[model samples]
Target: MKVKIYPIVRTAAVAVLLSGVSACSKMYDVKPQNVVEAKNTYQNIYDADAAVTGVYGKFLGLAGQYEVLNELRADLMDVTPNAGADLQQINTHNVLPGNAYADPTPFYSVILNCNDVMKNLTIMHNTQKLTDADYNQRWSDIGALRCWLYFQLGLQYGNIPYVTESFSDVNTVKDQSKYPRIALADLVKTLIAFMEALPYKDPYPAANSLITTIDTYPSKMFYVNKNCLLGDLYLWNNDYHKAAIAYKNVMETSTPNGPGDSYNYYNTYTLNSGSDNDAVTQSAWLTFFSRSMQDREYQTEWIWSMVFDKAFAPENPFINLFANSGGKYLVKPSQTAIDNWSAQRQTDGTPYDYRGINTTYKMVNGQPVIMKFLYNYVNASTGIPSDPLAKNGRWYIYRTPTLHLRFAEAANRDGQTKIAWALVNAGIKGAYDDTTIPDPTQRRITNLPFPYDFDARKLDAPTIRGKYHRNLGVRARVNVTNLDVSLQQNANFLAMEDNIINEDALELAYEGNRWQDLMRVALRRNDPSFLADKVYNKLLKDGNPAAATVRAKLMDPKNWFLPFN
Candidate 1:
């Protein structure tokens, strides 16, 4: 068996795992564990690859927080009676520094590992221990992962300690003079610079198993897509045009065929419901979130995924958090969220969104547990194995739908409201017909740019129709009616942006991005009421008496972030 290469990270990093981590200047300074000597580390390619895997192991530890911090604090999720006081505080937007989820140690631990991995990988390349190709791919993967972690930290805490170098002494990081705290905006700038400069912005080549297969799972889902992440960083940085370019890059993937090519990884869950394959259509949507990374069709829809297996690591925490039966059921979909899903129209001309009931979350034992994570876990017909399996499954940190939604957000802000609206309701083709835009001048303005115009059916007679027409709108994929864009001639981007945010809730809710979506939009408009009203309305639905106070607190931008102690 190959050696399990633990990262030779800083003493402070390992200490955080032992004794908790705090967000204050004073950090955990205990003697480091798992300290491997330099001579024993990164001796070859496999060794360096193992070190990156170790970083992912640390990332997996933070997977549960991706849901808790992002979802629990927002309107789509609510704490149940069984939830701890800490969870309650987060839901109410009154997070205490002492709240367990508020601690920054896990994030820093992963960041420190990423720092050490990059430092060692550089050393390996310099010493001729690795090929230039191997060096670039590994180095860029670790760099992107670090950038993603920092981005998440910045979003959650507002201002965070931006440390990029790897060190041994805990005091080195504690010395705020050298490594000062930077706001989310500055961090985004640094991250964009670092990622944009990486030589290999793509995933590891086929020969490199690090980017391909990890046991039964694809490591591509494990590593963050550099462009997808850059797109998100640009979004948070509020550079809409650049953000649109970044997301567009992910869709095209620098390929010859463009976004229409089936080879694209940013493909969404296509809904092709028909009499001949109604169940098959539902199953296609079902496997979109599973341990079935082996499924090529579903794999296209996943940009980044976290693997959890009962046989490999401990059982995933999601079952305990989201499953109603054989689970703690700490939190569930909020009543308002349920109502939103109920509000959508399914393709079968049904009243409710097919994704909402029995798909996203299901009624089991009289409780509505979040089913996205624990999908197919119950022995219901949806079970993947067709038998009871452990609750362990994959958690999507980023996926296809998320990329499209974010792209629409940036595009709308960049003055492509019709194109953005199309991405949400009718898709690139459906939203751009002569009737959709009507006037030739308006059509020209609403026309999708190169990659986004996958279908490319224009007024030109030759290029307007073909088999290359696969870009289904988010709502259209679910059998919902196309949005009425006829009345939107005078609509500003902000109003369209609000509609996009609503689409975000309908399309990508409970995937650990709901809160950030609400916060980002609110911050962009400088309208506290945009965000406050949503959470306040959620509280009123749940009958939480703190609704008024929570809404009042969120009216200030300061309360949008969690406390650091």
Candidate 2:
């Protein structure tokens, strides 16, 4: 069940050569033949840069991990009967050690790559080739990526052996006694301390950003930005006050075109125009997962995304699971997910949730197929449909809406219900209408002001011009209906909390993060029944007979964390 650290040297070296993908082809195109060659690889900044890129390449190959670990366990998705035994196990919470998705080796291998970059890059930096700022920035990037690996491990496995240095040989790795598993709480504390010590900024200027060679790198608001991880850790650690502050920094700095910002939210594609068809209604959100916007560097909302170049990196397996034309269509939307959207109706009896409108599955005869991962659309210019085999969608690690929602959760927990309500409102409004609207007076709509700050004041302004933003009949401003009245209003606050949770499910559907959201609320309230009830309800709605068993197990805190092996 534990990752053998010493034997990893051999495995790590093989992985680097096998997966040594880089955005800057000139530097990382060639893989090191041996550990000596790998050590020699970082002779200068170029080599150091290549080493950094290799770490990212290792991280990028985890799109499937996000889908399985983060999403599949949650109620948003149901496993297709023929999806595979492994995927079905994940859906049913009957995962075995042999489950293909249970392999933590890839994540451990990723940590090894980060360790390699940290060691070699430091050696090269000591040579004075990199400026102090450059060295710190690059080192910080490596540290953040390593922290990301540990964070994922902590979530997947309750506790794991914490290792900082690269293993020398198989003998060292074989000695489990040398690397004892550390509690996730302790690991979070360690990461927070390490991250806080580094000279960092939430939204580091895009020009001096890390991973400089890659234009599409999530230099703007990704986990690479320590604040993102800091917020995540703080949230997991239940440090609501600190978590709120961390998330605030992300909102103010990392938001697309926010104060002192430089990178676009997403570059290649624009938001949905709210056209009368699925194509336009889903465009703003769907574009983020489309192949067309994979590497484009323009106006974007992608806080951080895994880069996958069709011509450069290996094929993303997520495409095989999510995409329709070329995918196995293994994962499908659950009945609960369908009901989540169906329950919410606009004034006109239409779905008020645009995301639900676009993300829900449509029935083909008797079979229901999820379309969130299927980005098959007709090319506007080429006049041809997109290829299903195209693995173009970049795996989003963090985005503006999700961050806003996270901040809302933290804020709500900290009793800043207004701020929490505002965060949720912003996510909903901006979800489908992120297109840059002109601010003639340089104010709200035109200036593209940060949505997270909307709760600062109580005012009724003209809503953005979109079908989802207005009342079809009245043609007046859209009323914010979901915001809670006040914290003293217990029922209202609970309703707001529920709204935020649903919003997370709505905004972050198949991209991964559903189960964790449920866990966060459950743990925060110290109410095992809360988590159990929700999961049980979803399972029953889906007609799964294991609902009672899963509910009983979930009532125990130990069962909160999935079994490592």
Candidate 3:
């Protein structure tokens, strides 16, 4: 009764009246029909703005591939034998059948959206509603985005269709498309030009609206950003000098105060109780956390990320198909990885730096049962059993702790040997200094009181001998009570960059990145040990015994690059 006026009804009445007026207008009927009108059915700045928003919406389904692809390329998990799934099919060294044949479909989807945007832009420009400056700016932005997509496709698939303009018939383009592979060098140059021409000064806003409503999606994701793309391309080209410069540009411009306050790049560990312990305590500067298992939004650290919505989350067929709890698939870490961590350690007597150590070992019916990925534990006294092994809601993957050791390697690669050496020494010394010894002789201790040690030799050795024993017997009869002395000695021995890299290899073993790191070293120094030890051994274990007999056979150069499919 108080003269209520419903906004919805009032708006509908106005819309109907406007529609009637528009229907009778000959001028409106004479409007040119271009791609924007043909596709979006929207005209004028306001409607075109909505169209742009729809184009932006495509990004919501385009992130997360960077993490997945990077992790797969790293030495984390080998492709399981007879892996038939798409991820396995690609990872297992098979040649792609055609341009249409790509592992993750999102790659194609992104390209399609970019093409659509370009087509719509053409139509919108024809309408003459937008000024030359407005059209040029939007065109440049669209071109930049398309260039980025093409660059990614070229990097991943090598030979991919360079689709710039959009076609009216999607099926015709799809069927008649003869995708040509672009040269890496040429592709890099073109991408560089595209990125260089972009207006970095008047860049887009940040992606996170809650934190910064002014931020744009392109600015948040590395793939979309010019500086980030340049940095990544340079890194891929092995131009450390240029890569460092580009990365530094992003680092400096993105966060002027330094990585401490702004960069939330922390090592987040989720326990069996669903509690997370962020060890680094820094905001993530490189990656972000999102609710979706497959689609992750850009964190503060993310330079770029492919977005995925609930409807379009990518299915990693390799991880899903090959990773078996029992014996359904052959996906497993190589024995070399197992042996590498078995005897490794930090200078501080803490176990080696592996994230995914086999932790759940228990005696069952007087027999020791070795378990991996099992989280449930039984309290015999309280009769309370909790299954930690059960798959929780959070996405699971090996997360590497940001250590000074990696910085040392990066510095070394950048030819800052002095800084590299200094960082390595500090990291080693820091590890040694931070290590704590329990019982002063028999047991290894951590910040927590679980008596947990990942080093196999330390874990397996009987505590009755008054000290844990090394398998090598090099330091036999050494007083374990003097942990400081032992740690100091270890640090001294591992002070060199070479030794530190070895330690990194052994310590960070199956968590991944080993193969690529070794490859980088190989490229730099022509060291064959990476393949002799890490890559070849896996092949040898899988019935290629010739690979094991080092003198009997030589590895193919093709093995250096991962097979594309």
Candidate 4:
């Protein structure tokens, strides 16, 4: 460098020196990737939040499908006689042993997803830099979700694989596959613990406020955060004392009216009224109306419904297949159910019977030919009719909302005989007295069409033929055209079990929990209803079309308890 001639050479030598830098030096000098950067590559707070959302998503997915399982258990719909050679495929009566492919399978799938979320939430708490409060809240949310999943599984399947933690490999599935049937008492205990640990207040109330309120008339009321679940857990456990307390909490804290307020009721028309298939309408009592048939969203009656959206809907094979007319499959209400509804009556004037109600017969030249699911469509914006016969009807196969039956049962169990008696009396009055015939005059003409003087041969036999011939004759004698009087004596013969069971069947018809109720009653008392004799004489009458087949089906002693695969 001292020599002016060497300046260029010095610069060149420095450049060559820089080019010869060691790999270790380069490594030491490089800055390590920070947590934020690593999180970008993996899951960060936002990603964790998304995961929690997914956990909730599974809840929604399962809600709608529950209705189907519940309905099947209730024996409201039998396997369609023409369900093809794959007769074992149908799940009704005691025919679900070899039919693990039935609706209950999805319920387990949901439980797995719930288990994953709960496990991941723990991981997120340990690995992520979430605030203590945030972590606790999220943890509580996951607990609540897990509680619900387990509760449903227990209710539907009795003893189920209780997966509380996440799996690292497929082999873990086998390890976690302990199907020890959790007793209802233990299930309730677990549910209570989870509910107690969860955050009762909504974290994001405004954004999720639609999840909070009844948007319309037949409001689908929901429990605030965990209130409904708590109540339901108690109800299922037959802890009516606790259930009443929980239900009372919801009554005091949430919705249109307080403790004494009437609960809102809804039907398919109100539930799926819009083009967007939005269930936020006033009529929704509780709903699971998401793209994912698995997730039951917009549950008005639900204390907390699993929230599914366009991003995820449950995969429902049967609802669309059976409920939709356009589809190849058709699962109609059993003739027994039809006859039950037609024959049932109420002590009061209201129709407690839902037979022949809301059923659709196949349409030939616009005339109903077969009583199938009533297909209707509504405008997306106004929630008004677009097409009366569009197959766009959304399906919600499960309903866990509280029913008048619950109250009736509570009164009966608690020895509130008068109250129970009144409830039963009212229900009986409602079933028969309530008819499609608008006026008393019309009802008289419809039930006993033949006038006192009308010729016997010309009269059409009553659609319902039973012990009521003399009653019909009496009405005809009195010229008792009053619809109110026509139903006065109908439900009088209904006993306590009959009232509760009938109410459960009517209110929760087509929902998936009936089998559990049937099982529970069977276990507690050797009631004729759940016994083989009952099944034979009542469910499978000798002259019934599928009597022999049904008898053959139940011959398997193991059919009583569902198979665990």
RMSD of each candidate relative to the true structure = 5.9, 7.7, 14.5, 17.9
Best by lDDT: 1
Clash tally, candidates in order: 2, 13, 29, 58
Task: Give the better candidate number (1 or 4) by TM-score.
Answer: 1
Q: Which 10 consecutive positions of candidate 2 have the poorest summed lDDT?
A: 470-479
Off by over 4 Å in 4: 1-49, 56-68, 81-106, 123-138, 155-157, 168-189, 196-204, 207-225, 256-319, 345-356, 359-403, 420-494, 526-528, 531-558
Lowest summed lDDT across 10 adjacent residues in model 1 is found at 18-27
Higher-ranked by TM-score: 2 or 4: 2
How do all models score by TM-score?
Answer: 0.86, 0.77, 0.53, 0.58
> Could you give candidate 3's per-residue lDDT for residues 1-565 as a string of tens digits?
0101111222232222122212212212343442123333434444433333333334333322433343333344445554345445333333345422244345554455456655665677787766555555555555666676665555454544455555433333234245454554577677776666654322343321211111122212322455545655565566766665664444334331123532222211100011121122111211122222221222322333332211222322222322233223334454444455545444457553322233212233332222221222223222123432322111222222112334444444655543334323332122322235444332321222111121211332444221111111111111011122332232433234454455555434333345445554554555556444554555555444434544122244334332334
Off by over 4 Å in 1: 1-35, 168-178, 212-214, 254-280, 347-349, 381-389, 435-452, 456-468, 487-490
Give the candidate order by descending TM-score.
1, 2, 4, 3
lDDT of 1 by residue, 1-565 (tens): 1122434333322222222112111222322464445557678776776666666666777767878999888889998899998899889987766788888777876777678778888889999998899899989988888888888888898887888777654335545678788887788899999988999987665567464444555555666788888888889889989998888777756221134544442333322221222233555565676536666555666767776765544357787787667678899999998998887766566777767877777787777767888764665443232333565577678767788889888987776777777778766657655555555434422335653454424345433432224566677767676666752443677777877788888767788788778888888778988989999999999999999999999899888887655
Clashes in candidate 4: how many? Answer: 58
Q: Score candidate 1 by TM-score against the native.
A: 0.86
Cα displacement (angstroms), candidate 2, residue 492, comes to 4.6
The CA lDDT at 327 in model 3 is 21
